[model samples]
Target: MSAPLEFTLLHPANLTEAVKQMQAHPNARLLAGGTDLVPNLRRGIGAPDTVIALGGIDTLNSITETASHVEIGAGVTLAGLLASNLPTRFPALQAAAEIASPSIRQAATIGGNLCLDTRCRFYNQSQWWRKANQFCLKLDGDTCHVAPKGKRCHATFSGDLAPALLVLGAEIRVENAQGGRWQPLAQLYNEDGLDHLTLAKGDLLVAVRFPTSETRRSGYLKSRVRRAGDFPLAGVAVALTRTGDKITDLRVAATGTNSAPLLFDDFADVIGQPLSDAALTQINKRIGQAIKPMRTTNQPGLYRRQMVAALSKRLISTLYEQGAN
Candidate 1:
């Protein structure tokens, strides 16, 4: 590997100061855990002139509960999620946080998880491997090796937190030098494989707020090449609120399906109906049919599609069981 480049580091003590610094150096990248950024920097995948490290800002590492909502800071590490009260209250979110290895978990932030780069087997390689194939769209070439004839890129959405947060109806707070605003967690992404984040340049993600909904229940399930530290090839997050045993509200999101999280809007037609084995089976089938995963580093495309049903069923079953108890 090439020797690390000389880059200036900025340590901001608070959110406002960080935003100002970010505004001044719009090209500077924000670093929370540095787990993902450092590696990318060394491999020439990242070339930021300055890094604004958030570790010095204590406010960004907090996890607090208000009268009804849960507010999690952007700099909170995955290790914090595994160690927090979130597991008892949000088991699916906790489960997803623990999927990475312990070392990586300790060093990767939730913000990094939300902004994790999309992955493709052909693109995630050293400089040498890419040259042999004449490069890909994600690298230096115009053609996508995965789908040379397709118009759009097919990189996989590899985030574990995004689907879970979307199912929970989370909202993210983004601040810039001028001001701050909130956007539905779902809106933070676009359908494109490249340039997934919808945030404007120089905006810093402040925190994520989980909205209050007494009737709602949420869970996540994932499939990977290995049960340990591998990224998900297929993952699902399901959230629903029921009146007694009849569904009242439902939100379902799937990751690793395409460039962004896949929403099965057709399933909304069945909401307010009583849950039955047949209904659940049909719901699973619909989601399974909706997702379109491509071959990637995690697993084969065909196998990932098959996992959608099994994982979706497992997530809903776990949530239902929790509600019953």
Candidate 2:
């Protein structure tokens, strides 16, 4: 049986206080919505000595828009985004956020979703289950059950918003007690699943900023076992600009296929061409070759790989149709 969770909870009044608390207790796990962290804690994931609550910090929950960009606070709930004008303003982000069930949307924060832990069939089970199966590389065991001979873990990054944000060219603002900095959202993750995020000790994800442009068109597509409440098996997000039926700028990103979400740099090659069947076929082939899905979920790796192509084609076709109309 699992031991009861025992830890100190700290409620910070503001962002400053939150940062201070995090800096003071480097081992404290920051809790925003607790949709993911709480479950992991119950599964005996990381036993942090302290849990710093960021939900009370009002500034972290506000959404601000300027002439240049829209800044969404980390604490903004998925339901809040859906209810606000954000869906109309950024349809792709809205579509991704809408994938979670209604109840989860009400409680899950954007920041928590962004920093969600890498998941695997072996790692997410109960303590008893893990013990019975023998711990995998992500837990206490040295060997990766997914790839026993491989040196690293094979857990998959399963967040839905990350691919959308990456294709939109969003930037993340993170702060610590010492200072703060902004980076492209795509840079926040590494290929290693065990240590997926680039966040440092005491670092807090403040907000995500998306550049505002009238010419941009975007779409998001997800494939999961169920229509809702299930993490995606494969997903795609695409953003582009079209000038008189010719692609001007394009970005494509995928999630749930690798250790970290991927932004396809070669998508730029599709620019200056029309979104015709020939062009899409080439793009589809390129995407199929680029993504490397593992057998982490119950679905076969080949099926997940095929879904990547299928979803990419679907999203691109939808975006193209929207542009034509």
Candidate 3:
């Protein structure tokens, strides 16, 4: 295996110092858990001039649950999130958090998962392999091999947590050299795979916050080659509320099919009805059409879309039945 290109490493004692280090080196990458960055670096993905390690920042490493909401620090590992009371409260998130294997969960922070880099079968290869393919839009060459005629990169977002959080109405705290503020998590991404995150240079994702909410029932589902250790080819989250046996709210979100996770915005039509067969079919059709899966993984885009639709239907039905009980 080839070693990663040499890069400077900086360890900051606190958020202020971390922010300052990031500000001074805008091209630097942040190292929280190193689950994602380290492997990618070894694979010759990104060679940042410096890496600012934030693990020493105590303020970014706790989970706080107020009556208003549950705030999870960025440094909180996926295993930690699952072990907390939050999982029992938000089973959809728990279901999502339980994915990608136990060892990865132990070291993978929620923030890193949320900020997962877009992947493509072509781009995520060794330098020689990528060079042989002449590179793709995500990194070196101009043309997007997935959609050669298209101008945008079609790298897929394969993270699991964002979809669950989106369905639960989550927000995120972002800090930078200037200050910190909260924004809807949905606003954190854009469709451009090459530059998906909407976060400005030097902005740090500090924590993810979910609004005070209790649904009748919620659930998550994903499709992959193996039960664990593989990123989802397609993932879905469903959250709903029933009022006297009639649906009052339905939120569905999906990931792994597009450049960024998608929160389906027009499920309002299903609000007044139980999840009838027709409603489920409609939901499936909407999602199957909405996602723009590309040849970014071993599976074809068609298969991913079908799995996404199937998973969405199955999970929504399961959650509805659980709520009925």
lDDT of each: 0.78, 0.85, 0.86
TM-score of each: 0.91, 0.96, 0.97
Indicate the residue-level lDDT of 229 in model 3: 88
Residues 172-256, candidate 3: write the lDDT tens digits: 9999988999999999999889988999999999999987656547788888889868888999888877766677888899999
Rank by lDDT (best first): 3, 2, 1
- Model 2 / residue 184 / CA error / Å: 0.6
> Across residues 144-175, which tens digit of lDDT does each residue of candidate 1 receive?
87778986778888888888888777889898
Q: What does candidate 2 score on TM?
A: 0.96
Ranking by TM-score: 3, 2, 1
Query: Regarding TM-score, does 2 or 3 come out ahead?
Result: 3
Instruction: Report residue 203 deviation for candidate 1 (angstroms).
Output: 0.8
Candidate 2 residue-wise lDDT at 109: 89
Residue ranges of candidate 3 with Cα displaced over 4 Å: none
Q: What TM-score does prediction 1 earn? A: 0.91
